[model samples]
Each structure stands twice: as C-alpha cells, then as structure tokens.
Target: MANIFTSSIGKKLIMSISGLFLILFLLVHLLANSAYLFGPEAFDLIIVIMGSPVVVAMVPVLAAGFAVHIAYALILNRMNMKARGAQRYEITHKGEADSWASKNMLILGLIVLGFLVFHLSHFWAKMQLPEFTGGHAENVNDLMHLTFGNPYIFVCYIVWFVALWFHLTHGFWSALQTIGMNNTKWISRLKGLSYIYATIVCGGFIVIAVTAFLRANGYIG
Candidate 1:
C-alpha cells in the first residue's frame, strides 16, 4: 500500500480510478440537469430528489474524489515538467499524432477548474449551499435563466464547455488505457468510445446552456 502511493504507476492508477469516478458523476449530473428541459417543475423535482439523504450522503465522497483527482493531476504534471526540463515545448511538438488535448491536459484542466468555481458561485452557492445550511433554496429555473441569460456568462460557459470537451477527449481513453486496457485490439476502440462519450456529455451541457439562455431572453421556452 505504501509502495502504491510512492510509485509512478501507482499514482497513475489512482488518477485513472478517480478520473473514471468523476466521469461517472458527470453523466449523473448531466441527467439531473436535463430535467430542466422538461420544465421547471421537473427540474425542481430532480433537485428535491438530489437533496434526499442518499445523494446528500455522497456529497463528501464526491468532494474527496475531486480533491484526489486534482491533487494527483497536479503532482503528475509537475513530475512530467521536471522530467522534460528545458525540452518540454520541443517534446510536446514531437507528438504530432497526439491529440491537442493530450499535449495540454493540464492547461485544459486549469481552465475547467477556474470556470467551475464561477459556476458554483452562480448555482451551487444559491441552491445546494442554502439547502445544506437549512435556508430556503432559490428557484432552480429562475436562477438558471438569470445566470445563463447573461451574454457574458453564456459565452464563458461555452468556452468552458469547449475546454472540457478537449480535456475529456484525451482523459477518457487515457484513464481506461492506464487501467490495463492498453491492448492493441482495445486501443482504437477505446479512443472511439472516448470521442463519443465526450461528445454526448459536453454536447448535452451545451444544449442546456443554449436552452436556458434562449428561455431567459424570451427567445424561446
């Protein structure tokens, strides 16, 4: 166990597991947020269900998973930087076949993380935080409209989604590959699956954002 924490492969394995966990969580989150498409009543019902004891119990677990993933990612990135030393840029260019996201995972991750803080301020702080603290939660649809309705915020979210899409494109298959799915037979298949999964998840969020913006501005409902 101690060796696992200290070894390179061990750290990667941990990162892979945590990344997969977050990927699963993202799908669940997307499904929950999709309820907004049905109507405010449906969205609120999903929110109420999310506030139930079972989901509430998992909040700390989710937080810990995010912490572990972010911490390990930073550690591995720093190690790679040191290993590359002055050759970092040159080495990055050498991987011509590598996806852009593969070469710049750290940058994409930082962008996603930065926007995530802004997102939490707009939504989670108003809804989850208040509910957790026994205060009245805001109307989910109203807040969604108000936040996504802003042209600036809407544009920022689109940027965030784009970054997230790139990040996921590489991270998804890489995580699986690290977890012993590196056989030639599986390699291409995994990459294909990664693209599909990333497209669906990010695409869903983009659609939701556009819908909220339109509804908020009286363009549609």
Candidate 2:
C-alpha cells in the first residue's frame, strides 16, 4: 500500500483522483456564481448556504483534498525528472508522446496556483476569512462587482482563465487515462472529451467574468 505513494503509477492515480475532485468543485462553484448574472438574491442565498453549519464542516476535508493533489503533483514531477536523468531533454518524440500541455503542465500548474492566491486575496479574504474570524460579512455580490470593475483586475482575471483553460484541457483526459481508460480504443475519444469538458468549465468561468467586468465598467446594464 505504501508503494502506491512511492510508485510512479500510484502517484499518477492519486493525482488523477484528486484532480477530479477539484474539477467537481469547479462545476459547483460556477453553478453558485451563475446566480449573480440573473439575481443578486439568488447569489446571496448561495453564499449563505455555503456558510451553513453543514457546509462549513466540510471545508477542511475539501482543503485537504486540494493539498494532497498539489503535493503529489510536485512529488511526481520530481520523480519523473530523476527517472529520466540527463536524457529528459533529449527525447525526440516528447511532444508527440505528451503534447505541448503535458510537457508544460508543471508551469501551468504554478501559474494557476499563483492566480488562486490572488483570487483568494480578493474574494475569500474579504468574505469567508472574515466571517471565520467572527468579523461581519460583506455583501458578496458587491465585492465581486468592485473587483471586476477594476480594469487591471479584470484583465488579470481574463489572463488567469486562459492559463486555467490550458491546464484543464490537459488535466481532464489525463486523469481518466491514469485511471485505466487509456486503451487504444478509447484514446482518441478521451482526447476529444477532454477538449469538450475543458471548454465548458473554462468557458463558463470566462463568460461570467467578462460579463461582470462589462457590467461593472458600465459597458453593460
């Protein structure tokens, strides 16, 4: 069982499972945020529900999942580099075998993580962190509006989402492939599925952010 963490295949399996968890969280997050477009009341209800006792109890578990995913990613990358030795950069078909995203996954992950730090500083720090520390809660919608209204922040977020898109485009199918879906019969199908799923997840967030920026800037009503 310990080998599961130590072995290359096991590390990947763990990474894949954890990735799926984060992806599921993204879908739920978007669903809750979508309320902002239609009704502020609906969005507020989501904020309230997420802060309810039951949901609050689950936060630590969710955070641990994220920690495990990130830790294992770094560990696996180090292991791969060690296994390849100096020949790592000499592979002729590296792109063919892995594609651009697979080669760049670590770099993409770092960018996404950095943006997440910026994101939490803007949103979670103002809302959830305050409430957790017994401070008054701010209006979530208003906070979102204020952040997106800033031209600099709005552009930064758009760029962040583009980075996220590439990360997901590679991550979606890679997870499935790690979990025994990599037979030749399903390879092409999985790659196609990756793009479709990545598009929906990333595109949903991008559209919502863009709309918020426009609304905040008075370009839209």
Clashes of each: 0, 0
Model 1, span 1-221: residue lDDT tens? 98678877788889889999999999999999999999899999999999898998898999899899999999887777777555443142223136778888899999999999898888888888987789988888899989998999999999999999998988888888788887768867888898999999999999999999999999996
TM-score of each: 0.93, 0.92
Q: Give me the runs in candidate 1 sitting further than 4 Å from their true place.
A: 84-97
Q: What is the C-alpha RMSD of each candidate to the true structure, in Å?
A: 2.7, 2.6
Cα miss at 40, model 1 (Å)? 1.0
What is the C-alpha local distance difference test score of each model? 0.87, 0.81
Minimum summed lDDT over a 10-residue window in model 1 is located at: 88-97
lDDT of 2 by residue, 61-171 (tens): 788888999999898777767766444421322222457777788898999999998998888888888878998878887887899989898888888888888888778
| Model 1: per-residue Cα lDDT at residue 159 | 95
lDDT of 2 at 94: 22
Pairs in steric clash, model 1: none
lDDT score for residue 25 of model 2: 89
